[model samples]
Target chain A: MKKIESVKNPLVKRIKRLQKRKQREKEGLFVIEGFHLVEEALRHDVEVQAIIAEDNKNIPSNHSGAGISLVTEQVMKEMSSTETPQGILAVCSLPRQEKPLSIKERGSYLFIDGVQDPGNLGTMIRTADAVGTSAVILGEGTVDPYNDKVIRATQGSLFHLPVIKGDIEKWIEACQTKNIPVFGTSLNEGTTHTAIEAQNGFALIVGNEGAGVQEKWLEQTDQNIYVPIYGNAESLNVSVAAGILLYHLKLFH
Target chain B: MKKIESVKNPLVKRIKRLQKRKQREKEGLFVIEGFHLVEEALRHDVEVQAIIAEDNKNIPSNHSGAGISLVTEQVMKEMSSTETPQGILAVCSLPRQEKPLSIKERGSYLFIDGVQDPGNLGTMIRTADAVGTSAVILGEGTVDPYNDKVIRATQGSLFHLPVIKGDIEKWIEACQTKNIPVFGTSLNEGTTHTAIEAQNGFALIVGNEGAGVQEKWLEQTDQNIYVPIYGNAESLNVSVAAGILLYHLKLFH
Candidate 1:
């Protein structure tokens, strides 16, 4: 492979356009940079369009296994959003759940109704992976999972988990039809998580970062769990709250 | 009282300089941005040298109660590290823990030893606040709590909680001498967290991002608790793990 030095290369221009969600979806791919993420893609067997390494150094020996390309540092930087680039980037296929999950099939799942912060949503997905969540259902208003910062924050767990995007109301209804229980988190008299049995299989619903689980969703839920605050700090970060509830559910698993 | 228009204005220059650790220490002040954080500082009554609202066009009436200096939008943009400025920023004192806690007095506490990521450390502190931990001890290698990103993440929980910075070795000895049990988390056979009476006065030691808990400190701890993993992802992000454990332990509190 020869290094492409110009920033104006059509490939580079196309890749740079990936910063926009429309571009990413239109191309059916997302770009992740840094040496670690590239390695993560291969390790997870995610589909890759190409490996783009700048500086002509530290290229992973396995790059040859995939369609690899050497890109100039300038070209790579033009495509990366991070302030510091690690001389490596890759375009990987947007992974989907091998089979789109019906609420009935995913017993231990997380429903993200409207988590807007890419980092927060990413952390929750990463936490979901740690706690053995079956999948993450992106409800209305949630940020795109493929957002570069989110991909980075997931620390490659993004590859391992099935994060399905769709109408949350429909998903919730599907779960209801299938007898799959839905547990929403709220600040009110929602049951304390310790008192609930998340292991038998349930979908954990986490709401918007600020607005919280919508009132309608909370009303529709089979159970509402709260982490119970003993202090006057108002509320916990949404991702942090979801993480705690997810781990609590794991107690039964 | 007056809007400062230039990036090079003396006060603006000082604020920019305080972005660095050394300058912040020399000045005994740090700046925190975003409307949420400034409100937190206000609610907590942390001393504020000034509240600078860059462009009052979008400042909600509630965010203006502090007599904030109305500055040009450009000045706010210059002072902000975030791509989008939150319109409000504050220069606040580095608050000391109001009730300093030693190991013996702890029922449940978190010791973040050597956590380097400002966002992770801040989330841990925020988790500590939500779970009602006795204190969060920042040992060697931890990022300063007042780092702009961290302070924002903490959402003023830094002010609500006992957040003390101290030497790692000294804090370890203090715990041992006081006979307060230590719980270190690891991938190995640290007891599964769910099985323990985790609420009993213990200090949970979380360590650096790359390195697990220090072996020396690991040896000093009384009990080690591990959050069981169900997936191939090697580890949890430090803050998420901390939040899970902290909230889990709160079941007893």
Candidate 2:
């Protein structure tokens, strides 16, 4: 096992770079911190590039298969993004996005279009996983799933399902070709979700925090559906809306 | 209209104190920031104590009924909790908690037990409002809904609903006496939610983020229900779970 004692170490500096989107993109890797997330990465078979643990923190030296490097407190602090680092972190390779082949015949999917809030994106992914959605497709302009806030909010569910980023307009069109109903949410007008027949195969699209699903994408969907707001609340948070819709439309029996 | 130019002004000092729970409770007031939330306070008819906006900011001068106070940029910054103050804030009296004379004979309700995250509490309140749940009762250990993070997360839904804090055990017993079925969520053992019969009036109790419902609360419920996790994820976020359960058990027809 290698021991690192200085924050000035080149390896420590490189790990710190994973905090930024551009650096993550250039290196094709992202950082997962804390004991639970690191444990999740190994359990889910995510490619682990390296594990850095505080020298005296008592985090496992080997997470089943990945070797850990022991680093001094100062060194670990420099590499950590959080104010209070949880003693361990791992640099994992970003999962490759799947090329659109065809929509599955009996699969449930969630398409997020331009959801800017990292926490909202993460919660939605967790909801999508809990309901056994086939995958979560992030449209253009959505927050990065691997961002620290998103990953933290997911509570390790990020590794439980395939979350891919791609062109949402194309994905909706692909679903239509396969006879999979694509449902978009709209505030102005749409069939109340309860009126829509539940089906095993479908895709539900939720939009931005403010301006909802882009007009271009709404026009491409098979139909728009809404969770009727019975109270004075203007709208539900995007993630909460996703949970209600996915379970009602796809999972409830 | 009073114009406050110095951060040292006594009224300005009192307004800033509302950010703290003790101060808020003593004054019986909470602070709301930004145009949207301030407007919501007015729309919902919550009692307004004061309005502080940037001296030159073009916020509605009268806000229909309440008077506005112009403050210098530095004073506005000092009064605002967020990094980017929206150039406006309002101090409003906290909504009074209902006396809990008894549970509504035939009303849908959500009981939160020890949910610690401020954002989670806020999101759940928003969801409750969307589904028209009669009231949300926060258990003794739950996060304060007036915390800036929670208030921000609610996105003004706080003004749209009755959010009361009280004793969880007594509330559940009260519901039971009125024949309002109480449902508790658990991971270990329970009937699947989809299998439970949907009814018009019921109370759903969601527990802490890490710990599920307390054993005592779980034992008292009419039934314990679990949202069947169909994927590898262990469970949904507390707020997301609340959204799914509330809609399915209360709103879905």
Candidate 3:
């Protein structure tokens, strides 16, 4: 056990730095706040570097293996990104996310292209988990899955699935090699989403909040489908659209 | 058009007060920040009380009817809830939210019970609007749709639909009399959502993120259905689940 009472401790500063994407990538580590998220990280085989607690009381009695550090309340608050510090947090190695060299035969996957909102990305990851997609591939300009807001919105499901960043072209190529059809949302052309028959496997691409699928990617999709807007709203939230589409395609299997 | 430079102006204080629920309720008004939101409020026919802009440049030249106030950048910053003021804001009359005494004939509706997250509530409202539901009834304990975060998350869909607050019991009873089936999500009991037939008119009730549909309400549902978890995630985000369910019914119609 280590006691870290000073707010200015070098270790506390280092832990606080993980809140930024650049620091997290540089250290190859990220911070998970609260008991539930930390526990999920441990349970999912993520390598926890340390458990930082405001006091020993905040640490679960069953917790073991990781070095425990007792920090002052002020120190914990300083390191926390949330307004109210949850009293306990764990520093864990980032998940080993790799672009798939090849896709599984007859397997469904989600390809997220340039979805920027952290909350939207998180919700989409959680939905992707619910549908049991083989994986989630993030295209360039997409929000990082490990971002704190995204992680919180995921509700611990980030640990339940594999989310990796890759080029859209490579992902499309990989899926096509496996004979998995690629689909995207396009209002101006192609079949309506509902009109398409449920398939055994496919790759679904969802794009930015402001922009639909990028033109280059849209051109390559084996099919482009649009959800009919039956009301005055111009479009559905990207994540909501993805959830509806992913489940529709996956449920039949 | 009126020009004001002081943050201490009486009218400026009133607009700032609209951020709080009690004040908003008493005044029957709410604050919407940003150019797009203000524009949407006008386009949707939401009664705009005033348009406040950081400078004359942010205001459209075609503006008429409502009083427009030009304020200094500092004053606008003080009145805006967002970190970066979008330079334009509007004070609008709150929508007439009330309990429904009768249900519409053969029209789809969404019933939200106790969802507390402003973002989730807002996203659900946007999804409900996209599906063209007749109305969205927010049960007791749900977050105020007028809350700033909720309003922002809704994009502009908050103006596109009727979102009313009411008792869950009354809503269920009204639906029953109109021969509309009330469906709920239950993990342990109920048919899988995919197995259930889509209907032209019905009420879909989604409960609190943590507690799920109250046991009492679950007992009253004409049918309970669950979205099967194909992965290790215990559940999907509530709004995501609602999105999947709402589109399922809407698509079939």
For every prediction, compared with the true complex, DockQ reads 0.65, 0.79, 0.82
Give the TM-scores of the predictions, in the order they appear.
Answer: 0.91, 0.93, 0.95
| lDDT digits (tens) for residues B1-253 of candidate 2 | 5678888988778887888999988878899899889878887788887777885455644476566789877888888888888888888887665555457767888999999989999999988998889889988889899999999998888888778888888888888988999999998478988887767799999999999799999999999998888887888898888888888887454
Clashing pairs in 1: none
- The candidate, 1 or 3, that scores higher on lDDT is 3
**True interface contacts reproduced by each model, as a fraction?**
0.65, 0.88, 0.85
**Whole-structure CA lDDT of model 1:** 0.78
Model 1's C-alpha root-mean-square deviation from the true structure amounts to 3.1
Q: Summarize candidate 3's per-residue lDDT along A62-156 as a digit string, tens digits.
A: 56788888888889898998999899999988866674566888788899999999999998998888888888889999998889999998888
lDDT of 3 at A11: 81
C-alpha lDDT of residue B163 in model 1: 86
Chain A superposition TM-score, candidate 3: 0.94
Candidate 2 local distance difference test against the native: 0.86
| Candidate 2 vs 3: which has more TM-score | 3
**Model 2, native contacts kept:** 0.88
Instruction: Please provide, for model 1 over A54-123, each residue's C-alpha lDDT reduced to its tens digit, 9 standing for 90 to 100.
Output: 7557565566556777887788788788888888888888764445656545468889988998999888
- Extract clashing residue pairs from model 2: none
